[model samples]
Target chain A: AQSVSQHNHHVILSEAASLELGCNYSYGGTVNLFWYVQYPGQHLQLLLKYFSGDPLVKGIKGFEAEFIKSKFSFNLRKPSVQWSDTAEYFCAVNARLLNNYGQNFVFGPGTRLSVLP
Target chain B: DTAVSQTPKYLVTQMGNDKSIKCEQNLGHDTMYWYKQDSKKFLKIMFSYNNKELIINETVPNRFSPKSPDKAHLNLHINSLELGDSAVYFCASSIPLEGRSGNTIYFGEGSWLTVV
Candidate 1:
């Protein structure tokens, strides 16, 4: 079974501060990665996704993540963050095959981000 | 338009009671999933249905059953609910499992279940 681990449980940052959230997965085959964010009272929204091709993928709201196969990591990064960026972020991984039921996206314990103004 | 939607945004029920939460998606996707988010915000997949067929059933208890009447609806029914079942349940849908470059899941506003 594939599992996802997020190193940080909570993160606090000031406005305009750079941010990085660590995420690592345990999978040996082809995998699809995603970063999803949920605001205070909103549903989970896709931040970005990495299927194939480039390792670095940019997402909405000025967020980006790099899919490092060697490190088994897909870390979310942003050079500058705003107060509105305060939310819970989750890292997920899924295998390439659909019939592989056990390969469904495995989510990590979300990281609560608090961005101070 | 809402791509995914779930009914009873807030559900407060007593223990041992039976309750059902309805989920619907208008995305014309073939795969729908149910995920539970605990108090600590740990998300886990409970069930997934592909084209009205049961595809993925995690180690979830039998008390929690998923019913998909069609391709767009996937409802969750909890029989004899327990306190541990008190969590936020999210319904999500993605493109058909057969023909897709990547599965991008869209989640609905979760249904917060509080078991007393």
Candidate 2:
């Protein structure tokens, strides 16, 4: 079975500090990666996704993630964090297949990020 | 407008009772899914419906049943609910047809269920 692992359970960072959250998966086949964020009392929203393109994928809110197949990792990063960036981040993966329903996503235990001003 | 919506934002019921969580997506998406977020905030897929047809049913209990009257609606019905069923239920939608672009899932504000 495929599984996703998020190394950090909680992270506290001051405003304008650099941010990086580790994510790794246990799949050997082709995969589609995603990063989703959930703010307090808000629904989960897609932050970025990596399909079959450049290894480095940029997403909304000045966030970006790099897909390293060799490491089985897709780590989320932000050059500078803001207080508004305080949220829970989840890393997910879906196997690529022609049948849409055949693709099931595996989510990692979220990392709660607190950006202090 | 909310692309995906789940009714009864909060549900409180006793064990052994029956209840339903209604989900609807106005995005005309072909695929709809039901996911459960436990108290620990770990989200898991329970069921998925594509074009009103059951496609992915995870290792869910038999007491939990999902119904899809149309492509835009997928409702979950639980019979003899247990205390373990207390969690947030989220409804999501995505395009599943042929030639569909990247599968981008849109989730709605979850329905928090508390079974006492």
Candidate 3:
């Protein structure tokens, strides 16, 4: 089974601090990667996704993620995070089944980011 | 209008009770999903329906049932709810990502269910 692991469970940073959240997946084949964020009392929103060409994908809110196939990692980063960046971040992997019938999704436990203003 | 919406934004029920959460998507997506988010903020896919057909059914208990009247609607019905069932249930819809093999999901505001 495919599983996603996030390196940090909780991260606290002051405003304007550089941020990087490490994500790794245990899958051997072609897979789609995504980063989703959930603000307080809100639904999960798509931060970014990597499907094909670009290893470095830019998403909304000045966030970006780099997909490193060699290490099975897709890490989310921001040059400078603001207080509004506080949220729970989830790393997800979507892989096709061997039977070619359907796809499976594996989500990491999520990392909570608290950006102090 | 909201692209995806779930009814009963907040639900409080006692154990052994039955409840249902309704969902609808106006985005004309062919796939819909039910995801459970625990208190710790762990999100897990419980069920997924594509074009009104059951496609992905995770290791969820039989007490939880999902119904899709159409491609744009997916509803979840929970029976004999237990304390452990208290969590946030999210309804999502997705359309195939063009030129790619994957799909991009859109989530609803979610229904908070508290089983007492």
Candidate 4:
């Protein structure tokens, strides 16, 4: 089974600070990557996604993720984050195959980000 | 309009009680998923149904059953619930990545289940 790992369990930063959350997947194939954010008491929202285009993908809220095939990592970054960016971030991966059920989708534990004002 | 919605957003029951969570998606997605987020905040896939057919059933206990009446609805029923079953359960749907449509999964607000 494929799994995703987010190294940072909890991250604390002040407003205007840069942000980078690491995400790594153990799958070696044509895969789709995604970054989802969940605000307090809200549903998960798509931050960005990487299918088969440029290695770097830009998402809403000035966030971006770079898919590094060599490291099996797709890390999310923001040059300067705001207090509203405080939320729980999740990293997910899914193989391209549709029939294989097991490889359908996988989500990481999640990283709780607290952006202080 | 919510893309993915689940009913009984909050469920509180005692041990050995049986309960169910209902989900619906208006996006006309063929694939629906049931995921449980434990207290540790670890989201784990419990079941996946594609076009009303069971496609992925993880190593979850048989006590948990997922039924898809149609492509847009997938309901999860739990029998003889345990204290460990107290967690937030989420319903999600997405177009298959192999499909021509963009495959972006959307999640519900989450159904909080508290089993005492």
Candidate 5:
């Protein structure tokens, strides 16, 4: 039973503020990481994913996540965020082999970000 | 074209009633999954189907069952729903990530289920 923990439940900031959402998973084995965003009244959209690559993975809309294997963390970061970046962000993890079988996704309780104009 | 879609974007029913939600994916993905997003916005996998075969059945209650008629469709049926069953149900599809580039799951808009 792998579980992902997100410490921040809600974050409020103004436009241009730096953003970092912490995501830590309990799995110690090879795993795939993903960050998905859901805008108000919209479906979840992929921001980025880490299969096998550099620790620092860049995603859409100027977002990036660092897969810190030692800490079991893949924290999403953005140097600057716009008002349009306001959305509920989810961190998901899937064991490499289990994912290939059924693609079972275990998502974190989302972090809600609100950016003021 | 919509990659993944779910019918009855919103469903409301009384307790002890039976209801179903239908989902279809146009992405030609071999795997389809059902996920429940609780009120606290926690998402968990309920069931997963690969090419119409049940692959992962989470610890969800037996009252909730998922059926995949074909590779492209997955339907969820709930019998004698309870208030705790109220949540947003998401249908998602993804090709196996192994040896694949940028593997990710694409989710439908979600069906909101409310039990009175």
Candidate 6:
């Protein structure tokens, strides 16, 4: 079974401040990582994903995440955040199930980010 | 046009009543899933269907049943709903690559179900 854990429950930052959200996963096999964001009264949208190749994957709205295989972490980062960036962030992992054709998708408890204007 | 869409964006029903949420995907994907998001924003996968066949069942209550009439449509029917069933249900679809976790998953707007 694969599970994801996010470090912060709630985060507050001023505009133009750097942001980093920690995410860790527990899985024994190769995994695909993802970051999804949900604004107020909206559904989850994909922020970025790491399928293969590059360790540092960039996403929309000036966000990026690095896949540190050694640490079992995929941390999301941004050089600066805007008020519009305020939203709930969720980290997810997809691991192919053994003897099954479908993938097992698991999501972490979301981290609410509030950006002060 | 919505790539993935679910019906009844907001549903309010009394306890012990039965309700159904319909989902459709125009993306031509083979895999469809039903996920529940609690008030605390915790997401749990309830069921998944690939090519109209059940693939994953995550220990969800038997009251909640998922039906896939085709690859493009998956419906969730809850029998004798309870207060604990009040949550946002999301419909999602994705395509499988050559054995790797599919590149991306598209999600619906979600159907907010409130059991009174």
Q: Pick by lDDT: which candidate is best?
A: 6
Model 5 residue A103 CA deviation (Å) reads 4.0
Per-residue alpha-carbon lDDT of model 5 for A34-94, expressed as tens digits? 9999998777999999988699999999999999998999999999999999999999997
Pairs that collide in candidate 5 are none
Model 6, range B1-116, lDDT digits (tens) per residue? 99999999999999999999999999999989999999999999999998998999888989999999999999999999999999999999988645653467789999999999
TM-score of chain B of each: 0.96, 0.95, 0.95, 0.95, 0.96, 0.97
Which stretches in model 6 have alpha-carbon errors above 4 Å? none
TM-score ranking from best candidate downward: 6, 3, 1, 4, 5, 2
Judged by whole-model lDDT over C-alpha atoms, candidate 2 comes out at 0.90
Per-model TM-score (chain A alone): 0.94, 0.94, 0.97, 0.94, 0.93, 0.97
Q: Model 3: per-residue lDDT, tens digit, A16-101?
A: 99999999999888888999999999999999999989799999999999999899999999999999999999999887655565
TM-score of chain B of 5: 0.96
- By summed lDDT, the worst window of 10 consecutive residues in model 6 chain B runs over B96-105
Q: Model 1, range B3-94, lDDT digits (tens) per residue?
A: 99999999999999999999999999888999999888889999988889888898999999999999899999999999999999999998
Q: lDDT per residue, candidate 3, B1-116, as tens digits?
A: 99999999999999999999999999999888899999999999999887888888989999999999999999999999999999999999887433357777889999999999
Give each model's whole-structure lDDT.
0.91, 0.90, 0.92, 0.90, 0.90, 0.94
lDDT of 6: 0.94
What value of lDDT does candidate 4 attain over all alpha carbons?
A: 0.90
Residue B9 shift from truth in candidate 2, angstroms: 1.0
Ranking, DockQ, top scorer first: 6, 5, 3, 1, 4, 2
Worst 10 residues of 2 chain A by lDDT: A95-104
Candidate 5, residues B45-96: lDDT per residue as tens digits?
A: 8898889999888899999989999999999999999999999999999886
Best-performing candidate as measured by TM-score: 6
Candidate 2, A1-117: lDDT as tens digits: 789999999999999999999999998677778999999877799999987869999999999999999999999999999999999999998764334345567789999999999
Position A5, candidate 6: lDDT: 100
Query: Each model's TM-score, in the order given?
Result: 0.95, 0.93, 0.95, 0.95, 0.93, 0.98
Q: In order, what DockQ does each candidate have? A: 0.60, 0.55, 0.62, 0.58, 0.64, 0.67
- Please give the C-alpha DockQ score of model 5: 0.64
Q: Which residue runs of candidate 4 sit more than 4 Å off their true CA positions? A: A96-103, B99-102
What CAPRI-style quality would you assign to candidate 5?
A: medium
Model 3 vs. true fold: TM: 0.95
Per-residue lDDT value at A85 in model 6: 98
